[model samples]
Target: MAIMVRSWERLLLASIHDVSPRFESEVDSLRDLLSPHVGYRIAMLVVPNHWGNAPIVAGSPFASRLRDWADAGSEIFLHGFYHRDQARHQTRSARLKSRFMTGGEGEFLGLSLEEASVRIAEGRKVIEDITGRAVAGFIAPAWLYGPGALEALEEAQFALAEDHFRVWSPATRRKLASGPVITWASRTRARLASSLLAAGALRHAPLQTLRVGVHPPDVRHPLLIRSIEATFNHAARNRRAARYADLLD
Candidate 1:
């Protein structure tokens, strides 16, 4: 029975991260590029106000597109409030994770429970207000969460939360799946090369589930764009695209 279940079919899940009114054009390009491979099955992680600037205003044009995206079956996730790190670093580990894991976009790092709750509640409300539907989950900016942020997610009862290593339910505290999230970086040459190489290797990896992530910068780099589509084509040959919410089913 285990073998039969495992043999049913592998699944591929993909997402567009750092989604905001700030990068609307890049987001649209990514959506158009990915539709052929994933067919709007990608999750969108939205920042309510990117860097305290590009807020998803109530009746803005971008907000309307967000609602349309949700209506078309793309899952949305509350990414962060400001999408910028402002909390004082209270520990050495927190400091290192913020510095090395991401630029300065780890907004949830070093947050107190109360602070994290405030951001989460408001961010969720903003997205829900714009989309007129519940978001699929909450994913911290740069996938870095301080302990307070993790607890706050559960307190608010978000259905799912994902990091680089796994996707899990914050409410139930259950890790539904464990796998690496394949993604590309375009800020530097070496990092971009390494990511492309990793994607090439992952194309043929034997796994029951594969997850890919795209950021707005990826659309601007031609080579990374090619690699993205290539990875999708090769991986999708065997695994069908699936939604994050489908994990519960």
Candidate 2:
């Protein structure tokens, strides 16, 4: 018998989500956890105004810190215009998803194309102004985009946009087929169970690309934090660190 070695490019896409003035400490803590162990660039999914409040003002200490991270080679992504759910759902299923699935936090769940465009543009500009850097990508909060999200994303001229399962080029609408992401939500028992199952499954799967999306509140739970650390260790075993922007290039 002979042994055969297979080689593939493995990428670890890690990000800290819901970044705003209110969640600064949590984001900072997540960054500290990722800085040494991941050995790759991480994406910071910043919300211009989170929950209709806690806006990121320009030239403030918070904005300055974001600039520092951008200078250090981390990619900054516009998460959402306002990370709050206000859209009215037309269908029962949609309403159920909005209220239960996301805990009423899917900001773009039912927006029209024109409205989505305006909000996305506003968020992009605000982030650019605050960070003094070009915002290259956008990711909807909770990985949920409404009817006009793609169109709005295209109009905003972001290089890339990501949903829960995959990343795509906004310009061409082409899917990258990267792989499913491993994410956690500690809001409920069902969410926790599903997230744990996904993490455990991906830990042993020999995949070419692995993404880990971390929410600011995730640090509050010790079990989630441990799972995050373990997932990073397992994924980093044979993967290189990468940013969503890198996927564009």
Candidate 3:
């Protein structure tokens, strides 16, 4: 019998939202954990506009460190214009309902094509300016995007778009790879459960690409951090680590 070995290129993508207190430490730990690997690359997703305020890019303490990471060859991606709900609903509950409906497309689905294009373009500019580097991709807030969002991405000239399950080409409009994704839930128990499930899957299947999604809050969990390190080591042994931009090449 052939020995089953999980083979997948590991790519870590982290989403950083409203300047949280834990942001600095989490970033430090992540950098320390992944820096030693020869080919490891991370995509740091930045939420430019949250709560419809001025772009929060400049005010973040970790912004400088993010730039350093990019300088070291990590890819930076624009997460979303705002990481919050911006819909026509009147009530708070209604607004929440609208935000995530249809995976967040509903919130911006009503936007005119021109309006959507404008928003995406503006966000792209802000992120690039802050990082002083070209952003390689766009991932919508909550990994939620409408069909129209793809068109907006193309107009803005983003090279990649990462959704909930797969990484897609904005130019070709097709999935490049699909396999296990490591994402955290709100609770510690849920986060642990998901990491265990992901690790188990990685051990069994022919996973071509391992996409690990992390949020700032998840760094607090010891198990989550351990799982991340273990996953990286596993990938280093079996597959090359790459950034989303590598798919283009």
**Predicted structure with the largest lDDT when compared to the true one:** 1
Q: Report the C-alpha displacement of residue 3, candidate 3, in angstroms.
A: 29
Q: Which digits, one per residue and each the tens of the lDDT, describe model 2 over residues 4-41?
A: 22245677778889989999999988988887866438
**Per-residue alpha-carbon lDDT of model 1 for 102-221, expressed as tens digits?**
888899988999999999999989999899998889999988999999889999988899998899999898887777888898778988899999988877777777889999999989
**Superposed Cα RMSD, model 1:** 2.9
lDDT (Cα, tens digit) per residue for candidate 3, span 126-219: 7677678788788776665555676787777676887667888886776766764666554546546865676656644556766766666557
lDDT of 1 at 122: 90
Query: Candidates sorted by lDDT, descending order?
Result: 1, 2, 3
Model 3: clashing residue pairs? none
Worst 10-residue lDDT window, candidate 3: 1-10
User: Counting only residues 3 or more apart in sequence or on different chains, how many pairs clash (N, Cα, C under 3 Å) in candidate 1?
Assistant: 0
- The candidate scoring highest on TM-score is 1
Error of 1 at 233 (Å): 0.4
